[model samples]
Target: MAVSSLSLSLVPRTFKDKLNEPRWSESPRASELPLHHAIACSCDRTTGFDEEISGNCKRRPLLLGVVGSLTASLLPASSLLAQEMPANYRAFVDLSDGYSYYYPSDWREFDFRGHDSAFKDRYLQLQNVRVRFIPTDKKDIHDMGPMDEVVSNLVKNIYATPNQIANIFDTQERTVDGRDYYTFEYELRSPNFASCSFATIAVANGRFYTLTVAANERRWRRVRNKLKVVADSFKVLDI
Candidate 1:
């Protein structure tokens, strides 16, 4: 499996540094494959985290499709990712890989070896979202097989380590722009830690894209809905 890369234009850590920075800066990571950058808003215009994410995701085209695609069944009127998103979630767009997803404005980029792009909580690293893609000959996610069986095999055999316990809670399939996508919920528990997560996968532009958003088991309930928005928002764009 040959994986591709992802990138996002991250904001500087300090308020003073933000004031002097450009609106759309390049990703700081180095990669052999081409990487894309997010279209960011001017940092000085925001007063708090809420406004930052709202402004960033709303103004960027990368997220317009995401917000537009949330069906009524997926999001009730009161859902945060409904017609109007909360001010704390921003979009991370990879123009090159042709995929995008939302994440908390407070999270910072980190190197999660094997993943093209990732972001984690400043204090709790386990609460994070990451995306990676690999070349594939298959034309659609359905090419893998039935949703339940395929998801189970991937989680139990590929995603989880031999020593970890993997339990899949649910699996779903959706179609957007004539493309098929499979999203699932699962738990991976090891001797040291346990985490619950939602994963979305799709095959497009000759690549298999996977985006996972997770949180520690203890924090799952509190952050599940927010992370669900991230997982559902994963979009594979036309490259």
Candidate 2:
């Protein structure tokens, strides 16, 4: 918790910095986990294909604050985990749209989302939420309504305020081995994207799936120690 030299001059010296860490000029894969160099662990808010995950797990700052306090238990009416994420962090190549799951890698499969999707179909391509900002809006974000209600209506409509933006915390159901799914977690601190916000989750493909980790408020208190090794390295596989 010692980064503030004005956020270390807002980080980035050579990786052409502007906040999109992890990515060492390519050429490092076997299903990923070593291209760090700076931005620790990001898959936005991952965890889905857990074969007891690997990447040698061993990052302990109180286990990254118990995985960012279990991402407010996936948003059970908001508790918000303003930072704490890193457990030797791991996850790569997990994509399934069956009932909830994601963990990009395959070099992010040409990362595409859409509002227009051209000019190399959007840049900020670090893959796995840090820079998948993707705002051309209007259709084919998977045609909306179902990635946990487009991440709970974008945090209950652009970062909460109507009674702390609640409702839809998988009362819509979410499960594993027994199947059934649909999950969501959320938190915010506005300036509407400049004041920095984080703690988001969505799990769908059955009912739903969404997770976020925006950053600010001092890197969300130094990256909330690593949001429970990125939320228990989530899983929903079938692919």
Instruction: Compute the lDDT for candidate 1.
Output: 0.62
For each candidate, give its TM-score against the true structure.
Answer: 0.66, 0.24
* lDDT tens per residue, model 2, 124-165: 321123221121222222434456555565556544554443
Model 1 per-residue lDDT tens digits across residues 65-145: 213333222222123223344457665555445676778877877655445567889999888898766666778888767
If candidate 2 were superposed on the true structure by all CA atoms, what would the RMSD be?
18.9
Query: Which sections of candidate 2 miss by over 4 Å?
Result: 1-152, 156-159, 163-187, 190-205, 212-216, 219-221, 224-234
For each candidate in the order shown, give its overall lDDT on alpha carbons: 0.62, 0.29
Please give the range of 10 consecutive residues that has the lowest summed lDDT in model 2. Answer: 1-10
